[model samples]
Target: MPRADTPGTEAAPGGRLRWWTELPLILLVYACYSAGRLLVRGDVADAVDHGLAILRVEKALHLNAEHPLNRLFTHEPWLGVPADFWYASLHYLVTPLVLVWLFRSRAVRYRAARTWLMTSTFIGLIGFTLLPTCPPRLLDAGHGFVDTMAHYSSWGWWGGEASAPRGLGGMTNQYAAMPSLHVGWALWCGVMLWRFGGTRATRVAGVLYPLVTTIVVMGTANHYFLDAVAGAAAMGAGLLLTPYVLRCARWGRTRAVARFGPAAGAFTRRLTGPGSPVAGPVTGPVAGPVAGPVVGPVVSGGCETSAGERFPRQRDERPRSGAEPDASPADTGDGAPAPAR
Candidate 1:
């Protein structure tokens, strides 16, 4: 048996974690993240204003990293094409690959890591809903930022509108640029690889993956510097909340089992029929020896003895004088004389 406290054996109340169960859960979270982005498409004007506001803040702080990176990628085809692919493809690919790696190799940490990623993704969605900011590429032509993904669209599956396929661009919410989950998920993947990966090469990849992802997002004009910062901060918040989320899940599971366990048992019993072991008690004499002291009358010496009499025929004292003596063993209880012993 796997010990409950063991690292890899730790699981939800339902049962040990299995890939089949975990897959649906992951897909569901992704579905929710995608659906949330589509649902919370805030006003385009407001999104543009938010985007401009972020630019102003970056200028004030002297952190205008996006401009030069965007310019470089735009002017150079080789860099721009690859960076666009990185922005469009790796955000979806690398995160899940890292998750699968953790699930297989570091089972003990997979749950918490998965929770942090999911929690952070939802937080990003909330950011999108509250402050939908336009990506730098979508800003006016005067902003000097180029949409590298659009410029290099002929080389890839994505359309000019965004990362979605040619005609499916409308299905995506392009205004959800405030907190870039692209960067956040990459950071998650990087941390997992750095912590659980035993090799030096894995550690190097861990450090570089998120760093490059941040640059790619900026170079492709998909996210601003502050957006990447917010993404990391969201991941941090998710990490802090992971324990509480797990506790609540366990609590809800316990409550559900307590509420419906007995009814479910009864339903099973009914299905199995009365003859089944779990259905009901036995009706015939039991085969084993009597369990405890018998509590009924015993027949001895032609007289009935009450309960608790261990030796029914034995007496403590002699019979009274002149009264007929107690019958001998050879004599019958009806007063007939007995034969030889």
Candidate 2:
């Protein structure tokens, strides 16, 4: 069934989608998530201490489920290898693909959905920076926790460190385990699919994807159960904050238009709009005039004729076919087109 836009709002015109417009922002956020360790590398001993504290709390709450799950997964190579693969792959792949799908399909809600995903990611990044905690696999070997990826290193491209690819383990921040982005992102994808998808199978897949992700992360010893809880909390924060974020953006756009008029508003929209081409000459002002008539959207109070020329609104007329369009009247008093009488 075709979905209708909500009552108070309208989908963008021409059914246009701007998947490319937000690519840079997404990449920037990911780069921050990846490199933010430099700003707040928690003390190793302190991180381990936090990990132990988490275990104690989980025990008190009777929520320390990672141990048994990790044991069950590690005992069987059949389970371990695939869980390792899921840990290594899906965290990076599924989120982006779902984002693209939403951008293409859910025109009305895409902005809110994207905002939620980005907000959650930044929240997780802040958690990693402020409260870095070690995962089960990195705990003392005397503990029963097993790093499934390390155990199955030879079977796949990952090394003995985390599931980072061989020779790149150095880049992996093993201590950034408090709020698991894997679970957070998986949950985001699952939520998007469930909310936007129509079919029962799609909804089932949405539910199963996050459920399996939670199990996989714990089974692989990549996150504590509480870490998953924190991830969900971060996602919750994101969901709560997105509407306000969008409201502020809309208010800012309205203020800009009110202050600077429609031209400023149009320029602002182009800059923020999806896949805006304002960066290049195509959307930039035409210099002086072209030898031929320009025939496109008027810019800066002037009309463009088919012959690639620009003139003020007074010259707004179609040129005769196969004829050169007239040039802007020189600013002389007599030659100017008579006032619109």
Candidate 3:
């Protein structure tokens, strides 16, 4: 049997989530989003007009059911308090927990999931900035959209205004409600869990989580039905755009390699150890035979019979085929043939 620590086992923490790596980036992006929303707050008059326009559209479509639903939930403290709590807490809690879970267990999926989430969130932020639609609870008193969180303030730390922390309500952008990120993020969590989860119960919870979130946001009068639809639409757009984003990133890397490959290769060669092509086999001038004439004994035979003598002897030093020994007086010095002229 394979050991638990071996590859593919749960004990092998290969792709485990690195909080130090991901947390700061996630926090930075979210902070920028929050600040950007606040910075782009539209004029109150325009925001109210936009909200009223959405209400009219919903009414025409017979989907302006938020008013009745909000009234019903707020009229009863029992239902309204829990809805308020869900609104304030789950919006911040569930999505992040799901993200952490994905990062840890489903790390291969974490990047795409995170891309869809961040993309959808930024899209929703752009909508909020360009067309700040006020929430139902923020409409004029005659609209009958009770702010359930306000009515149930005593049950939680939320102020009698929006769901911001008791004193931090001023920091929030109340008019940026057109494409509700709450619904969009909830839907992302739901879809990811449904797709990647191992159990039937998990799949069911995945579906229920988003549906319940939709209800909670609507029941609390925090978002219009149309706002929820816009949120879902934003998520769809994100899912569609993520693949192109990844492809562009890959193309960028390929271009970078094409641009810097030669220099990178030279650097790699410099780092290579000895005996590698870059570092081995020196080739240059060395001690070799001098390229000039020779001197000394001129024997009849081509063989010089002397040390350090060059081969393929001089031209006139030829040996005749049927000739007898010379016995000449010059040859008497060593009994060798006379020198060739």
Candidate 4:
């Protein structure tokens, strides 16, 4: 397909199939999921201790999940309270929905896009391993943010809790919150779409998605103020790193074109060579040089006895006779005589 007026920088993307490149991406995604599960499920030792301690210290300073403002709205007897499933659903769907949309759209550069998405996701997950901060809902059971996964019934979607149930991935890392992948991925989605979104509608969609995601995590007690900030930081890191990623992509393509371009050009040139069926200056014969004239001998072939009058063709090249010219050379013209060449 032709490119849009708002072009993508994905020009000259090589002929690799989506599936082939997607292989490593799939593996990386699974690996990230595997690692995240392990981290979330296992104990975060000093990590959580420090995280909860921060929550404690923040609590002393009136910064906590159950801050007075939060307590007012989430007053006791709030239905299906902590781990608010309704809000949590938004968090889960953000990534999946955006992925599906981009895949189905008419955008160029999806392969590079998907690769970016996958790589950034794994990198965010790796951060989850290195710095495991607890969510506000989990920081000290009483005031820790709710584990919305623990809430089943009041989900906006019926099978909501079922999402996390059946141990979606074993060893769930519930407390790895220093850099929230939830926010990081959401921010990634926001940036990717914001950068690529051509239409006003698309750009707005990109901008709103992360803002909504932030609220969902906060309302569900899944992250802290700092988690969102940390996630934003992660996004900043990814953005900084993207240029290198794109540079590698560009270098790879430069090599591929150096390898393949001349071959294709040579092939095209050969197709239009001397014997080609098409007619053009380079590939076809001229009209056998421009024709000058077509004078010829009439069938009355006679030669002169004494002298034959020869015409250097007529000045206008009309045939008068093939008979020999009169030796007398006198015309019976009453008015005038035609001039001889």
Please tell me which predicted candidate would have the highest TM-score against the true structure.
1
Residue lDDT tens for model 1, 246-329: 767655654465456665433333323335432244354322122233233454647866675657677645679888866655
- Inter-residue clash pairs, candidate 3: none
- Once fitted onto the true fold, the runs of candidate 3 whose alpha carbons sit more than 4 angstroms away are 1-18, 251-341
lDDT of each: 0.82, 0.78, 0.78, 0.56
In what order do the candidates fall by lDDT, top score first? 1, 2, 3, 4
lDDT of 1 at 39: 95
Which candidate do you rate higher for lDDT, 2 or 3?
2
After superposition, the stretches of candidate 2 with alpha carbons farther than 4 Å from their true spots are 1-17, 252-262, 265-341
Give the better candidate number (1 or 3) by lDDT. 1
Summarize candidate 4's per-residue lDDT along 146-202 as a digit string, tens digits: 444444434334322222444352345666666666777777778767876777887
For residues 31-63, could you state the per-residue lDDT of candidate 2 as single tens digits?
Answer: 886788546678899899999999999999999
- A best-first ranking of the candidates according to their TM-score comes to 1, 2, 3, 4
Candidate 1 Cα misplacement greater than 4 A, ranges: 1-8, 11-14, 261-341
Per-residue lDDT tens digits of candidate 3, residues 23-45? 99799989999999989888999
Model 2 lowest lDDT segment of ten:
285-294
Q: What TM-score, over all chains together, does every model reach?
A: 0.75, 0.72, 0.70, 0.58
